[model samples]
Target: MKLDFDGIRLQAPFYDETHREWRDSVVRPFIDKEIVPHIEKWEKDGDIPLEVYQRAGEVGLFQTGYSEAYGGVTDGVDIFHALITGEELARPGAGGVAAALTVHSIALPPVINFGSEEMKKKVAPGVIKGTHHISLAITEPSGGSDVGNLKTTAKKDGDHFIINGSKTFITGGLKANWFTTAIRTGGEGIGGISLILIPADAKGVSRSSVGPKQGWICSDTATIYFENVRVPADQIIGKENEGFKIIVNNFNNERIGMAAGAVAYSRVCFEEAASWAKVRKTFGQPLSKHQVIRHKFAEMLRKINSTQAYMDICGWHIKNGTPNAADIAMLKVQATKTMEFCAREAMQIMGGISYVRECKTERIYREVRVMAIGGGSEEIMRDLACRQMEL
Candidate 1:
């Protein structure tokens, strides 16, 4: 029997011809040619080469949902289009490729939405062209999800702000041209936070790799140090002491993209396992013939379909500009949990062979924790959802 992997995707009303074309024609071919062939080498090298980013830019991969003036293809793009991009990027099952290639998605939005024309002119074009790289520096060594309590400080000086602090677990940090950074410029807590654009080559800016990680090895995580790094005061992305709201708003898109990727990764796991089971024999016949293995496929498909539906509704709400932070938060948790379950079951079904790097399930199994913990920990997501529900 043939296993229909595409049939696993829900027939959601939100996806039209454009979405399908973008997935099937644009992103899918790109991943098949540019990414899939080199995932193992890149993973072993601990970082993806800069050429991949330039190639992605040449194909308009980085331009979706961005402004036309800055080389973004906005006329036909919507939230679902962006989500489709995320889903396609996850197809190779090397989460590091997706994370490293798309780090600009998290970093550039604040600049586009809240930055001055000068800032936009300086930052957006080169990044969209894939000639330059940028990273969002929000997760400090002292905290991850606790954005309000971050300890990075920026003291005002003549015509500049003296930034003196650090950020950890920063994706693409080592090669970034600029950092859309969160710095403390006021008193304390959330009220004191502000966003700033700091050139990575500035006088006191330095970084070291936070590598040998459990996963995302090709993404090049870093622990950045700022020792009295003096950046012009006007480099602030938005008004001082009002950055918390911007940060909160940014999480909605990030979480949505992550959710799309997570659900897609879950589907990848299901597809890999099912393909393996159909051929791998056990007691008397193929593993796919076993009642127990068939049940595993059933459970995996059930969760994958449900999560895709949830993601679609959330995407619709976001496209209509009525995004609920709570629902987006919860959807992230749901997608990651679904990924965890599918990965575990897929590994079990594949048995010892699944433990090797040759299979996508092995890499996906290693990546489940990062998906659950990176955007927001499952515990933090649940608590945030409940708090937003006013429970």
Candidate 2:
């Protein structure tokens, strides 16, 4: 049994034959051959080799949901393509690897949508081709998820802006060649913020590993510091002081991808536990024969199916052009909580073996916290949903 809710062939209205073919022929084979075998070493090293991104690019993975002008195949691809990418990537149970490979998803949008033609040509082609690394920098040492209260300041000189601040918990920060960063430019609060692209090698720019994290060990999270980094004035992405709206709109897609990954990860836990239970005999028969174990599987399936359903609905909403921030926010919280539940149950069913590093369940259990916390925390998502509803 595949036992994966996402892979169960639900005939989701959003995904057609092309999407399935891509998932089966391209995404699954790539994960099995490239990711599953070497994930342990990458996790131990705190990063994947740069060539992984290059290989992914060569296979059209990064181009799935982007625009054709900028090296994407968006003529036929839609929101579902992006969702499928996230789901299949999470199948490896290596969220860090997925994050590292797709950091440009969040990082390059501002440039693609709002940057000058020169800026777009300079970065998008290389990024889409998998030869460049780009990441977004918004969370600061002090701000955490409070984008409105960011303290990073950028003072403009004749031809350059002097940046001074630090961002922490930045995924792919150590290896990123360019950063699509948020900084304070006008005054206090969200109205004053602006987005700028800062090269990693700029003078006075420095970064250090955030050190060992609880999960996402394979991701290169870092604490990036800027003392007096000078960025060309034209490097600003979008209009100055109007970047807050961009960030807000960007959160919807980010949360959607996070939710999709969470659901797939839950299914991974289910598959692992189900396979384990079928063979490991207990008192007399297999563990799956036991009532309690069967009940556990039932509960896992319920949550996984519900999450997948919500994910499909949300994808449809996005495709049809709906105001879905509130719905997406709530779905993010729902998906992460479901993932957390499934992971805990899988660990319980597998017993001590789930606690060791050798199993996907073990790595997934460690990774659940980051899923809930990153993109946006569960608490933040709930509050954002309420606020979007004007509650």
TM-score of 2: 0.97
Worst 10 residues of 2 by lDDT: 1-10
Model 2, range 1-391, lDDT digits (tens) per residue? 4665554424566789888888888888988888889998998888899898899898888987667888988787788888888988998888888888878999888889899999988889889989998999999999678999999899999989999999988989999989999999899998999999999999999999989988888889999999999999999999989989998888888889999899888888998998899898999999999999999988988887788888889889888888488889999998999899999999999998898888888988888989998988999999998997899
lDDT of each candidate versus the true structure: 0.92, 0.88
Best model number under lDDT: 1
Runs of candidate 1 with Cα error greater than 4 angstroms are 1-4
Model 1, CA-based lDDT: 0.92
Model 2: pairs clashing at backbone N, Cα or C within 3 Å: none
Residue 197 displacement in candidate 2 (angstroms): 0.8
Tens-digit lDDT string for candidate 1 (1-391) = 3454565777889999999999888888888899999999998899899999999899889999889999898998899999999998988899999999999999999999999999999999999999999999999998898999999999999889999999999999999999999999998899999999999999999999985998898899999999999999999999998898898899899999999999999988999998899999999899999999999999998998888999999999998989999999999999999999999999999999999989988988899999999978899999999998889
Give candidates' CA RMSD values in order.
Answer: 1.1, 1.4
Q: Choose the strongest candidate by TM-score.
A: 1
Please state the error at residue 261 of candidate 2 in Å. Answer: 0.6
